[model samples]
Target: MNTELPALILGGLAAGFAIFSIGLAAVIGPKRFNRAKLEPYECGIEPTPHAVGGGPGTAAGQRFPVKYYLTAMLFIIFDIEIVFLYPWAVHFDALGVFGLAAMALFVLNVSVAYAYEWRRGGLSWD
Candidate 1:
């Protein structure tokens, strides 16, 4: 009667199902090949050739700018802030001043990061 038995069983079933589905698809799926289908897609933008030694008929690839990852990380940071805020709000009465102080500190830290990003132009798309 291990407490973890149910979780382990559920995990095994999910993994088995995933593997079975993939195998089934490979066995029964139609094999279709075309130039357009083979080419890599980049958010509707035409793929560019590699920066070095990439010419005609070579594999096309491009390095995304650091700004793209930075923007994504910023979004995640703010989104996580909201996740923490919602639970704190729900338990505001029970937590009293301690929760209020903790949330204020958390908000201050997040705001500082936001202000820094804004000042450094990390928030700008261009």
Candidate 2:
């Protein structure tokens, strides 16, 4: 329990500082607000001529390419898988052959999916 005391104190101080910052922002920040500020921001792109017509957020709204989503999902999947490797690496001696075999299979599975996506032009920019 003594070893945990420093961590607990550090955590409490960090949390308290976060709360203080939020409170300070609220108290000192501007209160002025307006329609433009309230409106959803497009990525610095000029609003389309058809914005007010068709429907709320109609086909006129900018359509992001699907490649963006696919690439993001692939990144998240591999990133999470790599994160799992860190803990296994930390406890490598204890986990032994079973952990080694399991990690190998995991890497193989992710690599296969990555190759498939690459072959399908999922990784390409049009």
Candidate 3:
């Protein structure tokens, strides 16, 4: 009863389950196709053909609200920063002054970037 053997077996089972679920879904999924179904739909609006090299008036790579992307990116950046900070905090005694200063610098850098972005209207909902 080796521990490694069970771990390996579990890993293989998980992989097989993933493959099986994907295969099942592919086989059971709907086969119907239509212009509306195949086309890209955004906000219930149908896509329009794009001119060569693209243009703003056309649907070809048209501009969207940047706030959505910026908000998501800011969320992920802060989330990862918090993840790193948590581990360091747990080992604060071992890290000592060097760790404290390093974390301070890290936070300051993030704060400056955040301030710059905010001032530049990146954080604006409008």
Candidate 4:
């Protein structure tokens, strides 16, 4: 018997189960529809129409501020830094001084960007 056969079977079972669950939900779940339900919801904020372009035409939803994207990017950067740090920490002894130096440099680079953002008010919500 192949060693990977069990893994393949488990994966197939998981996929089949997921598909079955979605199909079951669609068939049995409530189909209620209303105007309020159909409208876009954003953190309890009422949806408002805004101009898509600088022209006269208006769109259905408000455009997000650039600060939202900036905050998300910063979160992702720090999250990725934590991800790299985890593996390095787990293999700390094996990697020795080389890993330490590499991680130190990585952290320094990230800190510089963090400081720059702080100084530029990128971290501030307002």
Candidate ranking under lDDT, highest first, comes to 1, 4, 2, 3
| Alpha carbon lDDT of each predicted model | 0.83, 0.82, 0.80, 0.83
lDDT by residue (tens digit), candidate 4, 1-126:
699999999999999999999999999999999988887766544445565444555555554556677788889988888788889889999999999999999989889988998999988977
> For residues 1-126, what per-residue lDDT tens digits would candidate 1 score against the true structure?
599999999999999999999999999999998988887865555545555334677655454556767788889988988799898989999999999999999999989988998999989987
Candidate 2 structure quality by residue, lDDT tens digits, 3-68? 999999999999999999999999999999999898788644456655444566575555544566
Ranking by TM-score, best first?
4, 2, 1, 3
The weakest ten consecutive residues by lDDT in model 2 span 57-66
Preferred candidate (lDDT higher): 1 or 4: 1
Positional deviation of residue 65's Cα in model 1 after best superposition, in angstroms: 2.4
Please list the residue runs of candidate 1 whose C-alpha ends up more than 4 Å from where it truly belongs after superposition.
Answer: 1-40, 51-63
TM-score of each: 0.56, 0.58, 0.53, 0.60
RMSD of 2: 5.5
Instruction: Check candidate 3 and list the clashing pairs.
Output: none
